[model samples]
Target: MSLAPSSAPARMPGWLLILPALLFLVAFFVLPLIDNSLRSFEVGGEFSLGRYIQLLTDTFYLGVIVETVVLSTAVTVICALIGYPVAYYLVRHAGRWSGLIVFLLIAPLLTSIIMRTYGWQVLFARRGLVNTLLVQDLGILERPLQLLNTPGIAIAALVHVLVPFMVLSIATVLQGIDQRLEEGAQMLGASRWRTFLEVTLPLSADGIGTGAILVFMIANGSFVTLVLLGGGFQTLPLFIYQQFTTTRDFGMASTMSTILLVIAMTCLYLQLRLVRRAGV
Candidate 1:
């Protein structure tokens, strides 16, 4: 006797599976952004571009924009310079210690940002370890130097915080590269430097691009680190904070937020293009 064919369970639609996530984003992310964008244009309950005009035209505001871009660029460059070597070592030679290297790289990220920033403050304070070491131990300075709340210190702190991102990005790309390729290059009489310059570097460009985009986007929106360590440096975030809290100009604050969002979106677009070009 032949048995009746068993019925199969119906499969759910892919969109249905993600409907909750979509609704959550709409409620939390999309709605807030739309509200902010609308507020930027609203002046006394009417649409106006006065806020944008002022932000774009005023030299002080313009300077803050330029300074924000410049600071992000500097941080990106410095992170790249510091991260590449550590990534190279991690990927090429870490061996059994790779886990330890990765742990160290990620440990700082697990700490609270406020705590990390305060740690920097302590190290750079007037009677801090750095001042003590330079003046008393090393005799490098006649007295404690003013190290805290400066642009250089801010940049250094940012680099210290962001370099791990760069290293991890580059390390991920490096792991995908074939060892045979490097060995072949060496066998063809290429020196280690030449092999790296021509082969490894070119292949790892996508990682550098990805890391640069990440670092730049983050540095653009950085508030706490800059606020504590920047010595009154004016960037868009700080300016936006001042506009909201001090000047009580919500419209201007919203406009600055919109501008910062645009900048971040542009960097994200570049990152996507880079990923696509790399076939990743």
Candidate 2:
């Protein structure tokens, strides 16, 4: 026999509160994704495998996808390399100076991304401020560096944009760590270096992995940074934009976007696996 209505556990309003969010997600994200996916499989507005076949056979599209993934990976690695120490210092060393350091970490993130990209534009351009400083003031070089329009500069700019995300993800994990653990390690004849390697790094692996995934995803999906710095290097984002807007082929763009979605989902899955294994 079914239980009476009143015998059922009273449900919390947390779900009720989230109903609007759920609705919005369905309306926006779910619908758009479904439509895009449908479009990716279509030819002339009907179901077909032509789009997928075309994408697979197209060498240019493949190159664009590879370039985007590689650039994003580079950005993620750079952000992790630089962001870890900054996060570590904020979590471990800074006490009264924590507020100041945190602000310094957050200031760039707070600025508009467009503004940041423009800053890079000015810095990296031939005869720009960086070139002038390097050649005239620092005497590091006799000529202005051609830094404005290369894959390396694009990656560098993207890294600058992405580093803070890595730092924030790492900072959260660092904050959660017990300070006494390090003290205990010190008492047990472990030097600071050994303690960090043995205790801190292992424990902070989840955060590092999370940050890497976040940065990598952002870098992979980037359009503005690549367009401005790449100067027509043709990443997936720029390619999609051109496909839809210039070439006026929404189908190809959607196919490319689907490929990107696949890549993002794979990265996310791997990140979750890593985090789970690390016991995060």
Candidate 3:
């Protein structure tokens, strides 16, 4: 007698199943990107690289791009440093307060960005709580220092806004790790620090990369925080905003936008490569 076949039936092609989503992306994302890129090259009713050439030759624009990158990188590093410890604590030591801690960490995300930026504005004002303590109570300065619209304040606000993302990303990864591995390492003559360095750190590398990418991308594209907290500092996002709104220069705006897009994509690609190579 012949045996019955036991294989599963053939499934629909993966591409066919995802065709709707692919079409949506092509229509909304790819088409817009192509249009903007083409717009960036158009000038005087003809195809030209005038916008890009102008951006390259303009010292002010170049400086804004540099500042934006520096600020974004700083925010990413700060978020990682602060978030790693918080995530580790939540995963390993929160105990009874884990729920409360997680709630507090995520609560800010529910608030509007405009509201958050305004809150920072009030706190960083000349006579705000910070200056009151520094000047009146502590005598750190003779008078209120200018904190609003400053680079430091911008970084601080961005950190506050982005740290939760870092925390969540890292905590998700940490939760998936087997506690026994850490216990095993420590039981086998390894110190806590050694176990973390050798096992936990490597294991959580992917989370770190993910968090950094999210923070960096958000910070790089930020306009609200810089506007309310950066105190007249110009970044690439602000430049793009002004080009379109103030100057009515769509070509220039499109050029800066494309450049920003390229930078963000490059960083994302590099981070993924690094994460993959680390086996994370």
Candidate 4:
């Protein structure tokens, strides 16, 4: 005998709610990626990775790749260092001031990235505030220092810009941690540092992992920061931009972009594995 169908239609509305987002992703994200991947392989309708192969063979492109990796690694480490203390403070100490502190963390993020980078350009210029302070006010330097358009400046700006995301991510983790766990550790005579290392740190691993992956992805594709701050040097994103706009080499540009995407995905995958092993 056939069983009578029982209606459980509630799940259908939930799926309907997400359908718009699914359509948007398909239209904007998935389709574009597939199209770009196809474009990277073709030159006049013939399939080839000659453009990508050229990128590896070219010393300049290789250097761009190395620089991109180094910059991202440095930014991620700096963010963690700055973020951990802030995260700890917000979670444990800030109490009545937590809301304001969270707002402060988000303040710079609300500012436009291009505008922030431009602000750095002005601040770091030879005749800018930095040199004015050092040379005129402090009488420390004989000439204006070369702060603008350098790797150091780029990394500094990057850290400044991205630190909030790290803080937020870490704070999200900290918020979820049971206060009882830390109180228990303290009651058992564990030091604050010991409690953090043994309990808080482990519990917050997932948020840290998410933040690191997110920041690294942004750092790797950094075009404005690298361009304005690196002083015309090329990371992969900048190279791809130049190829597309300056040289009008769509094939090569698409290839470079594809390589960047692959690298980003690979790094994210490794981070996922690490976070899993870390038991986050």
Candidates sorted by lDDT, descending order? 1, 3, 2, 4
- Residue-level lDDT for 56 in candidate 3: 82
- For model 2, residues 124-236, the per-residue Cα lDDT tens digits are 78988989999999999989988888777777778888898999999999999898998999999999899999999988888898999999888878887776666557778
lDDT against the true structure, each candidate = 0.89, 0.84, 0.87, 0.84
Consecutive 10-residue window with the lowest summed lDDT within model 1: 1-10
lDDT of 4 by residue, 96-122 (tens): 999999889878888988999889988
What is the alpha-carbon lDDT of model 1 when measured against the actual structure?
A: 0.89
Model 2 root-mean-square deviation: 4.0
Clashing pairs in 4: none
The predictions' CA RMSDs to the true structure, in order, are: 4.0, 4.0, 4.8, 4.4
Q: List the residue pairs that clash in candidate 1.
A: none
Model 1 lDDT, residue 96, Cα: 97
Q: TM-score of model 4 relative to the true fold? A: 0.84
Q: For model 2, what is the error of residue 48's alpha carbon versus the real structure, in angstroms, after optimal superposition?
A: 2.2
Which model scores highest in lDDT?
Answer: 1
Q: What does candidate 1's lDDT look like per residue over 2-47, in tens digits?
A: 1222332345434465789999999999999989989999999899
Model 4 weakest lDDT span, ten residues long: 1-10
Q: Tens digit of lDDT per residue, candidate 3, span 135-203?
A: 999999999999887878888889999999999989988998998999999999999899999999988
List ranges where model 3 is wrong by over 4 Å.
Answer: 1-25, 138-140, 267-280
